[model samples]
Target: MSLGKSRLWGVVARGMAMGAADVVPGVSGGTIAFITGIYQELLDSISRVGPHALTVLRRHGPLVAWQYINGSFLLSLFTGILISVVSLARLIGYLLDTYPVVVWGFFFGLVLASVIPILRRVPRWNTGAVIYLILGVLVAIGVSELRPAQVPATPLTLFLSGGLAICAMILPGISGSFILLMIGIYPHVLTAVHELQLVKLLSFAAGAVTGLMLFSRLLSWLMHHYVARTLAFLGGILLGSLKIIWPWKLPSDEVAAMGDKMAPLMSNTSPWTFAEVTGESSYLLAAGAAALMAVLIVLAVDFWGHRRGAHH
Candidate 1:
């Protein structure tokens, strides 16, 4: 299971893409993994971080355990993810503030484009899967509707936020940053990253690792045993999140320091009515172009992946 250097580098590149997506509040890194055809493999790799891997390590030594658990791939991927997050967090935060529509519009397209390929992969499609999909949609919408909490950002809170956010990050439709935003921890966490607060960052990382180790197993298990229903639910999540990523929004009074003009609360509005209501340029064409590009990019990736698979 050892990979060539080029293959490891490819994993790193994919991890960077996932990390970039996770930085956005309305985007999931899992979306990148899914669209790129590595979603199950990623889950399997993460799920290997427990007893079986350790037992192998003790019995067969480092190399055997490493290969057995896909350790090289996971290590390279997570290394790239960490590097990307550390380096790009500030830039992404700025984009979210300054070009909200364009950023969200592009990701909206990414998520939308991802739905078909993912849904098609379901092992069995039936009425029950449809019901679960609808249910997932409802739950996601409900989540989107809830107001951001004004909770205090204590150490314990940050730990919990890290755990919850990491769990969300791995789920196809849930955005970890959005979970942080919902709990009023997004800004605080961003501040830590921007300021290079080692203690806070380390604590969050520990929590993230714990959450990933636990939740990824559940996700992997579902993929193996109940893939149809899981895909339907995840697809529904992507569908429902469209509300969050809608291009036009009316801002609420809440403000945060991280955003130069960040509005805390926003409600989606029709594109036609956006400029009239907000008295700002709708940037409809720009957003539409971005959306188009997003769709094209996803299709291209999928097509290329299939081609590569065939070549193999």
Candidate 2:
């Protein structure tokens, strides 16, 4: 394919992968972007909607702001994520209920598999990187243990939450919805989305746009000026999040209602211990292992292809 065509397909694939990840709670689309070698570009694209965007909007008009929006990239990626979330929400919810173990097992495998590429990306193995990795792992474990809370779902709060959560969504090792959950806003935000509440959605979108622009610029700066340390830090965060994303577990004592759905408020137990030995556990483990292996293989192939192109 031509370069343009190849790039087009690449974006499309990325969108689809991101959408798929967003459909799952623990997994992140940002991780997928990183593994696919588009992390920096993705960040840069978001950063493009910087202060200059607002400046243009004020000096010129909405059209100028529109111009600043990197429509192609944002549309492709977000469309993918939106499609996945909308289409798979019920399916994923069902799976999580009926076959929770297997689903989580697969996610565990994915996170485990991701460590390889993240580690390989480090230009050098050093004490700093090791420390960062450990720190990241610890943070992820800590976040996993946090309890979910309920918050009033007002416009302002929803807007702010959306902004922050969306920023997290774009960053590997961060889960936007999980962040929402932490802020006691996940249920409301999700409810708004499910009900197609345009006002709430738009408010949230505004926050997301603002946050993405500001955060992306900061991320780009860090990546350009402190590539190793930044990536190392992100790698560590990804590692830490493994605890959050690990599949398999006991039911929570706390639950919250969002319309008809009853969601778990916190994880009071770990996935390793089970009440009993069952075929479900075995099936989930195998499935999780398989999914993780698949991601690893795909990443390896992409890396090899990149290397070949560079050589030629």
Candidate 3:
């Protein structure tokens, strides 16, 4: 059955949260989905929209096919994501450019709280799981350290970038926009969204649909067969992503001389030493407040999830 009336709004809100997270460089909408308890449902629904969906649509009426695909839930969720991306992307982009520390601090808390749910999913703890966690963290941290490489914004590049970035966006640890940024096309995509460039946006959307169809199957299979290993590995990835959202950074080459000579280059710095390193205001109080709010919001969502589970 499709989601009930009472739960529909919640799913949309979660999708909005995911979209908001995805717009940020260090945040993943998948992390928001996992934390809000819709991750598996999303994968299941997306995985169904392949040959099986076509067969169902042809054999059964539109109603039956829609129910089989959980169309209402997907529709509600993606609607929210789409609204947020189109409506909020520009504002968020402004915030990130202007108030980097505060933005990261808020996201840092959101991600930090996500770890609790991810870790609890580990069915049993053992040496293997621990090793997996470490490996994930190392991989995430290593990926976080890579510098962005400028790439062309041609139609082919945009299509491939969308496909590749969507794959990472669905992972709890990686941010798809961050992937785009790393590939040097993030600014281009963001501009397209902000400017209503139909051709570029359509190309990106086509790529995303293709990638989602392929990745959802693999992800659903992994979840079904290797639950513990998958969760543990994801936990590690989330843990390691902490390095990416450190909330402090050294100057880019534009501000001061850096060997790479980039305009927005940054290196992570400790909060305590941020002032000393950047010779600028750190806004520690604001950062702390934002982080606190994020933690509280996450805990509230967790409580709501438990209540829903009990009701079911």
Candidate 4:
């Protein structure tokens, strides 16, 4: 599929959205890709960047190899992602710090609405699909329930963390940022982005590339073979993760005792109960509006994608 200039820019815009989603702890960029109707293409493109592409280059030429792997699409998409992560890092960090509920409200709505498209991808429903969905929910909830662990800030650990987190990042409903949070390097990674720490950033990027290459093939194969069950499972993961992104939260007793280091492990609470528990305004109306806006935005994107597909 050749992308004209406008379509190329459209892919970039989608990448920006994905990057923004990735910055948040409870939102996955993979979900954004799925919603924007590019998830499969993205996986296929990445999966091609191995020995097959090298062979193509040897037999044909660099240009043919690049075209075979949809190099322009990957380049344009990642360019947008890089621009967004670099530009929005500080801004998103500030928003999360100052307006936690509103920020989380947007992400929660995004993830919530995203589940529709994901589930819709399932070709058919059956007992196997139902079982996979349930299993996915259980796995997501189990991962969410884990406490944060401390790790050294060494390069090796950062590389490993990057690999692990990137795997989660590309999986629908699983947030790479949240994985970093669980691994106790969320702040450091954010700081590295914000501060332009080249060494740290490069280490993380190396790991991310390694992980992306390794995982994309497996994902593509699963998507090709067991698309229905896989999508069912992914949709269930999105549903199960709603607990983590709930706008109103209170620090668990243990989390409170652990101080700032463990603040991300908060327990979800109702908006009404939030004020009483935290002695702060719940901002329920604001949060609700933000969530509604997010949902509307996703719906608009979905509508546009479908229209484009129909035209094609």
User: Could you give candidate 1's per-residue lDDT for residues 1-312 as a string of tens digits?
Assistant: 888999889989899989999887788899999998889999998899898888999999999998988989898889889988989989989988898888888988998998878887777879999998998888778878877677676777778778999998898888888888877777878788889988888878888888999999999999999989999999898898888788788866765434334556777788878889878888889988999999999999998887898899
TM-score, candidate number 1: 0.90
**Candidate 4 residues 1-312, lDDT tens each?**
467899899899989988888877788899999999999999999999988899999999988998999998999899889988989978999999999999999888888988877887689999999999998888889888877777766788889888889899899889987888777787788778888999999998898888999999899999999999989999999898887788998876754113244453478889879999888999888988999998998888888888988998
TM-score leaderboard ranking: 4, 1, 3, 2
Q: Which candidate achieves the best lDDT against the true structure?
A: 4
Q: Relative to the unseen true structure, what is the C-alpha lDDT of residue 113 in candidate 1, on a scale of 0 to 100?
A: 92
Q: Candidate 2: misplaced stretches above 4 Å?
A: 1-3, 51-71, 86-94, 256-272, 275-285
The alpha-carbon RMSD values of the candidates against the true structure, listed in the order shown, are: 2.5, 3.9, 3.1, 2.5
lDDT of each: 0.85, 0.73, 0.85, 0.87
Which lDDT value does model 1 have at 234? 91
Q: For model 2, how does the per-residue alpha-carbon lDDT over 1-312 read when each residue is reduced to its tens digit?
A: 123656666677777887777777777888888777778877877787667778888998976576566556666666776777778788888987887767766666666666677777777778887787787777777777766666677789878887888877876777887887776777777678789998988888889888877888898998898777677878888888876865545557777554457766544244345535332344545665666676676578557646865897
TM-score of every model versus the real structure: 0.90, 0.82, 0.90, 0.91
* Top-TM-score structure, candidate number: 4
Which residue runs of candidate 3 sit more than 4 Å off their true CA positions? Answer: 154-156, 190-202, 252-262
Each model's total of backbone clashes: 0, 6, 0, 0
User: What's the lDDT for residue 135 in model 3?
Assistant: 88
